[model samples]
Target: GRKGDEFAYSHVVARAFDTDHHQLRISSARLHDALQGAVAAMSEPMVSHDAVAFYLLSEEVSRHVKVVQSGQGADEVFAGYHWYPPLAGVDGDDAGATLDAYAGAFFDRAHGGVCDLLAPEWRLDHDASRALVAEHLSRPGAGTAVDRALRLDTQVMLVDDPVKRVDNMTMAWGLEARVPFLDHELVELAAACPPELKLASGGKGVLKEAARRIIPAEVIDRPKGYFPVPALSHLQGAELDLVADALHDPAAKERGLFAAGAVEALLRAPNDALTPLGGNTCWQLGLLELWLQAQGVR
Candidate 1:
């Protein structure tokens, strides 16, 4: 315990973490209410409501501490996300083609499959989105696939999603969130390490080994995790009614924010009760309505 405590105090003591289990549930209890408006306010629809809701919920507890540390940049810099592995594109060795394969996987995975339910005109083409990724890939940076994935994420996702969400939500409640993993000196050093060393036999192998020396092997040996969330449970009662009203409302359907028939099809499926698209699409459309109503768009 001394060695573990000593190592943590010396190395990871930037700020204390908030880990009160009961407080966590109470904080996130209103996720549905928050997202109903927050989602509508976003410029893009693809941002994950589940993730953002938790980020906002964390801020609720983080308010007590005033300042808290976050493991924000670790995955982006260390190739920690399972999706960071590289794949071969149709045109082997062609940099642009290679990037297409890389960016395509990201788009398909992160964008949620709800595009199929969009009113034809609302579907995302990603010509514009692809261009953004293509531009990032073409930039001068690390050459390996894993390295490129890290490089691309550092420039794009690191700040856009993780860092931005934390900052926005926490600051809304006067909480300050610090990211030690994004240290300039550490990032510089991490970039120079061989790509294989980063994603070697396992993703984040180097980071995990360094952690192994100080922390128990069992603690650092676990598989990657997406924070567990009870999305279906959170949608029960008035929350479910909100989604139903948003999806089945004849007036809202006339405004053309969603394909009502398609969405209702999802709501009606007995086997698909817990489907991801069912929740994601409804949340997006519901939020859009809240935002529109707030701005007098309707």
Candidate 2:
């Protein structure tokens, strides 16, 4: 729990289990200080926003524990994302439709939008992201559109993004994390379960039902909560300054990854310019520049 930003429902479960619970609260200043360290820890750049929270949380957790179990692969293995439902009744053989649906729901921005953001020289001639998705979808074993989407997410996106974020952040503090849902046997079982079963109860239905037996209904039935980090989400004060600095730096201008006009527009309205996925676009762009500079890539 992170003080004012805590999910009240989590506290309910803690009380029910009578588990030793500890909470960590972070200030905007402390979070800003940890940002560079979080970026440095990652093997590659990620714009997942919650990475800093994981970094700070892991630092605190290491004081008490060496290794901890995390629920990392549950969503991918169990089909818990909002994108799963529309693909539910889609024809198994319609690979194009499946790729379109998945791209519509998950890609941060469309290819045209990405082209607009990048310098002309940096823009790709084709939808490389879609090509990547299509390659994964064509792979053997997955039976239906939803199955392909699940397989793609579980095998590709989850490994690179959330799992990597957790690994990098946790290991930064000498803390080891075990993702039980990713155990080979469990993943295989989850992969084999009918998509309909996993998509029920508003997604992850099977897991929710199983959880009902042990945990309180409130925790199981409530809306999925992403770890909150408000300071980064709606940047202001020193946090906003940090992002502005990175995007405007000499190295960023020399590299010219983003179009000058696009970068300027984001700086003008940092809070308003968001990606289709609701990410702060300024932060995403700035973080890339920051990470590159940190790595001495320039």
Model 2 error, position 118 (Å): 1.1
C-alpha local distance difference test of each model: 0.60, 0.87
Regions more than 4 Å wrong, model 1: 1-23, 26-46, 52-60, 88-93, 109-115, 123-126, 232-236, 248-251, 270-279, 287-298
Candidate 2 has its poorest 10 consecutive residues by lDDT at 1-10
lDDT of 1 by residue, 112-185 (tens): 34565577677776656667777777666556666666788998888887787667666656678899989999
Best candidate per lDDT, number? 2
The clash count for each model shown is: 0, 0
Residue 65 accuracy (lDDT) in model 1: 77
In Å, residue 49's CA in model 1 sits off its true spot by: 4.4
Q: What is the lDDT of residue 31 in candidate 1?
A: 61
The stretch of ten residues in a row with the least summed lDDT in candidate 1 is 1-10
TM-score of 2: 0.96
Best by TM-score: 2
Error of 2 at 254 (Å): 1.5
